[model samples]
Target: MVWKDETKEIYTEEPKEENIFKKEYGNTDDEFTYIEKTKGRDGEVKETVKVSIGKVSRYLLTKFNFKTIFGSKTDKIYFYESGMYIPKGKTKIKTEVEYLLDNKCTTHIVNEIIEKIKRKTEIDEDLFETFSENNLDLIPLKNGVYSIKEEKLLDHSEENLFTFQIPINYNPKSKCELFEKFLDEVLYPEEIEVMKEWFGFHLYRRYFIKKGIILLGEKDTGKTTLLDILIGFIGEKNKTGMALQTIAGGSDFTKLSLKDKHANIHDDLSSKDLSDGGGFKIATGGGHISAEVKFGDYVQFVPFAKQSHATNKIPPNKDVDDMAYYSRWMPFQLDNVILKPNPYLKDEIISKELSGVLNMALEKLKYLLKKNKFSYIKTDEEVKVIMERSGNPLIAFVSDVLEESENGIITKEEMYQVYSEWAKNTENLRLSKEQLGRNLEKNCKFIIAKKGTQKQGRYWNNVNLKGNYSTFLTSKKVIYLQSKDDVSLLQYNKNKSVESDVKEPEETKEEEEKIEQVKIK
Candidate 1:
């Protein structure tokens, strides 16, 4: 073969094959680098071309006479903070783009190339994705922890911190009236506030929210609709659907569902209706939990995103009075449901109100996130009652059978018997005496100490023996036990003074570092 030039210029000496391959492909170019033309089943020629993403990757190795000119010499992918892609890298491509603008390229052509890059950046897979809402490949959500790819939503706007890539959308009207309509669907006031907080959570990742929100009630009361709207804001790919156990569990497959996820939703929890909350607590609480990937070693990461679950029934809880468990829970109730609601309501919200709702939520998050505190309205009475009822039957059982006076005493055995009888009669309320004792110690209502004497070496509530049991209340005051078991607990008793052996739960190093790193100047 002979080498020729475009302007009819020809070389007297023919180019060697090795020199041609080396110069055109590279030193390590594959022997199969030649273009192959084969007819398909339909008799169409199948052309082979090598594609290179700026020498960063060359898996396909597609060939083009253009000679990979689309690839930028800059090492970094160029996507501005405002969800727009540029043809060059952040640092190196600027001068080149400037030179092209100053020389042969028109301003319009440069902008057109930018738009093309936005549509198809022709970058490596590690650099960009094919436009999935909040796709992880494009947007990195680790605010102060992992390597991040931060982007701005608008020019000169503050950079939005994201752990997952979200698709950018807009409101045609640029207003959120349907969002208010969505909020109106929630009949309760406290639940409305909770939804707002949830909105705040999704719009901003820096708040480091501690609690997770779950909607407890029958369907059609707007739980599904509210969650669907939130999902719309995050984009479909960034959101995942997994049972609570799957998310909180150590299983490699379940843990994989969480990788680069914006939300892990537990929608149909028909089987595991009662949650011991092992994984639930982990997802909402800011801390490190060990997880393993497929065929990979175990690694630890701070749980990202607020976990949201919806159930027609209350999920049972094992950790009673646990600050770690309770503090991480943001429970709400949706009453007076309208089952079989408008099926198209979710679509309407997504198309019309999602952007506005996001706008409203961001506005609210700017204020709520200022202190990095979740100071939202407490759960309503219905929400509280539902949480208590669903949490542990023993909570109510102990309060009902056991008295709290100085002289009044209910042994662990007695309380256990009462709980057992109650559990047997109820559907999902059975627990052993040993289990009862454990839960009792965790209860924040009353004291559990050695019954009046050591011979009775067992658990007892309201054990008032002069000053014998007084030492147990070392740091906290001993509220005079009430005689009436029916008295609604007005004040929550503090935890048993920290035992030297019992280690307090500490925040993860990631969260601690993030707090320090993101501190406002």
Candidate 2:
């Protein structure tokens, strides 16, 4: 026997044609028997080999063995296994067969197919190798879409938390210019200064004073309109934009849970009755409203109302938390008096200019947010500027002047004179007493005094008369004497030397004795 190199050469031999089976195995109990196809010379059984046919191997026999035996056109084979013979008929075997083959041969065929596929695919093993080396795990899904675990998502929760610090320095020049444009072009130029002053003061307090802005006024006084304009300038849909939630009548306050990093605009607040525990309390006081909410399973206390409104009265002795919430806002009342329409309300060109200015301010705010810098306009200088620009000197000054004036009525001319005096006296040049009164009277009847006295020496002695309380002099120079005779006593400045010359005469000794006796009764 000669041997060849095991790795290089395969032994080849001429194939011999031999009968696959010569068997006559019978199962008498099953009523099935295998018929012998070939016999020895003496017609006796020489060899008994069982040939098995399966669904798959039977096709191989028909295509290969039968073609080899008869002709290429032939398509039949005879085979038998376990007392069953398969011919080209309905009785042919259809069960799966296990072929006993050499393991090395089977492995060689599979490896060849895999190698072919790999070569055709041109798989980049280096790419996967680099990824594995770097310990980077990536999952590729259909198309370009992919997802990571929620925990693995980048953290934006920290970015969402916002704490607006006080004393925001609202630019007066910019605010004034914008407001002037709005006044002159949009709605009312006269109101421009008023709006500017209002926005300036509130924003200043909000940013510097750490107060919330509250506007109270009658319907159509442009409260909501002004708010809408502000919102428009700020870009309501932007990331740093304002959020408006209009409260209808009887709506629960729990709907006010505001998202972080957003400004809330509450509109139509007056519709809610504050007499009963209603929306007004929620706006003034923060609390949880328990009601059968449409979507909630049970009544849950949700923290809603964040601002206050005069339309809603705050409950007395509200929770401390609610009061604290209410204290955050800076409230202002809009004047009901109508003035010339603001230019911003009518002139589109000026309105656009104002909007551009407001947009610039918004950009500045964005920059501040990015830098993590919190600032506000808190100086008295800034406040004065706001007051002057807002055209609301009268409103700002009225309260102070009313307290200072001898009588509430200061003449119209006197009002202007006082304003001029105040302008010179104060750093802000706010309005004076008379000016404030005149301004108040433009909208409603307010207290104003005549110049000097109309009848300085006149006296009323006998009649006790009463009417709507008109302005009265409390000075001793203007006297009202009590006399039953209807006689007017004319007297000079007697007792000028007396230390307390203006004492009323007492008719009291007997009356006082009688009052002491009332206790005995």
**Each prediction's TM-score against the native?**
0.50, 0.28
- Model 2 CA RMSD to the hidden true structure, in angstroms: 30.3
What tens digits encode model 1's per-residue C-alpha lDDT throughout 14-62? 6554333221223224332334444332334445543222231121122
Best by TM-score: 1
Q: Which ten residues in a row have the lowest lDDT in candidate 1?
A: 60-69
Q: Per-residue error at 31 for model 1, in Å?
A: 18
Quantify all predictions' global Cα lDDT against the true fold: 0.49, 0.32
The prediction achieving the highest lDDT against the true structure is: 1
In angstroms, give how far residue 193 of model 1 lies from its true place: 3.0
